[model samples]
Target: MQQLLLQMLDGTVTSLKVFVLTLIFSLPLGFIVAKGRMSRNFLLRGIVNLYIQIMRGTPLILQLIFVYFAPYYVIGFSYDRFTAVIVAFVLNYSAYFAEIYRSGLQSIEKGQYEACKVLGFSKTHTFFFIILPQVVKRILPSLGNEVVTLVKDTALAQTIGVSELFRVAQNAASRMFSTMPIFVAGVFYFIMNYIVSKMFDFFEKKLSYYR
Candidate 1:
């Protein structure tokens, strides 16, 4: 049991690494994608929209497999498994997050923009100081849901052989020929998601002042 716990702990670390790195890259990339989706340039908007559609329409496991193998198949170069997993996860999730951000950005009334104009605020100032705060408040719930889903989705790294938590559990279960290791991994997942939920709840309460 102790050995199983230790192995799980190591695997959990890998899972957490994937989760954190995905968020770190995806959040900012999502914003960029959102901007492109909303661009005045028709060609840019079309390209971004197409990218988002492809990402959101496809299965993440398929994306992971493609990311892991495409380099070797197309160009005769190989990617490290973890690198491939992170790239796949980031690109996939950024599309969802981009839509979330786009919705929040569009939700702000024209009056707010007019007010910023009346105040002689620069575009940068209006966005960063006046608009973004409200958008963040509005999008927090949706963002939280995505974040929670990301916790579970990290397991998909196993499809590319990244040895994340679920992969580790599968190996252990196969070795022992029992389901106990899988159940233990479930506990780990539940605990992680519980913490994420509580953290989001706390943020929601703190931001209730926006209401």
Candidate 2:
């Protein structure tokens, strides 16, 4: 059991890495994609829409496979498996986050924008200062859902041989001929999700003033 716990700990590191890196990259990319989706530029809007559709339409496991293998097929060399996991997860989650952002942005009343204009605020200043905070508050629940989902989705990285928590659990279970390790992995996921939920709940209360 001690040996298994140690192995699981190593797997936890990989899982946490995927979760952190995906959120760090995807959140920003999602915002950018949301802006593009809402842009007046027809071409840009279409391109962003296409990307979102493809990402949301396909299974993430397929995307992981593609990301890991495409480089080898196209350029005759593949990048690291962990890199592929991050790339696939980031791209997949960004599309979902973009839609969440889009809905939150659209939910804000136009009067707020008009009011900002009347205050002679620069467009950038108005958006960053006045609008974005409110958007964040509104989207927190949806974002939290996705974050919890990402916790589970990190297991998908094992498909590409990233050896995340789920994979480690499977290996230990196979070796020990017991399901205990897999159960422990589920406990880890549940704990992660609980923490994520509490964090979002805290943020929601903190920003409740936006309501």
Candidate 3:
């Protein structure tokens, strides 16, 4: 029993690692993509929008396979499966986050920008101080949803053989020829998602002042 618990802990750690890395990379990358999609330059905005569409349109599993295998076929290079999984996850979530951000930014009243300008604020200052706070408040709920989705999406890493929770459980089940670990992994996923949802709910309540 202790040994089984230990193995489960190892699987939990793998899932946690993927989740952490995806958030670390995806959040900031998503912000950047959001800015590009909203760029003043028509060409840049169009390009970023198109890229976001492509990412949003594809299944994550397909993206994982492409990221893991495309380099080897096209450039005679191969990335580590873990690296590929993280990269693909980052790109996938960035598209979703970009849309979240764009919607938040758009939801703000036009007068806010004018007010900032009237206060002699630069565009950068206006965005950093005036615009971002409201945007953050507006999108926290949606962003929370995406983050929860991401926790579940970590299971997709198994497609690329990354040994995340589901992959680890699958391997253990194959060895033991039993479904116990698979069910155990499912429980872990549920617990993680529950924790994330609760955390987001807390943040949402804290930010209720803005609402």
Residue 209, model 2, lDDT: 72
Q: Name the lDDT of candidate 3.
A: 0.88
A best-first ranking of the candidates according to their lDDT comes to 1, 2, 3
Residue-pair clashes per prediction, in order, are 0, 0, 0
Per-candidate TM-score against the hidden true structure: 0.98, 0.98, 0.94
By TM-score: ranked, best first:
1, 2, 3
* Candidate 2: segments with Cα more than 4 A from true spot: none
Q: Where is the poorest 10-residue window by lDDT in model 3?
A: 1-10
| Model 1 agreement with the true structure over 21-50: per-residue lDDT tens digits | 999999999999999999999999999999
Candidate 2 clash pair list: none
- Per-residue lDDT of model 3, residues 50-117, tens digit only: 98999988898999999999999999998798899889989999899989988998999999999998
Best by lDDT: 1
lDDT of each: 0.95, 0.94, 0.88
- Cα lDDT tens digits, model 2, 76-160, are 9968899999999999999999999999999999999999999999999999999999899889999999999999999999998
Task: Name the TM-score of candidate 2.
Answer: 0.98
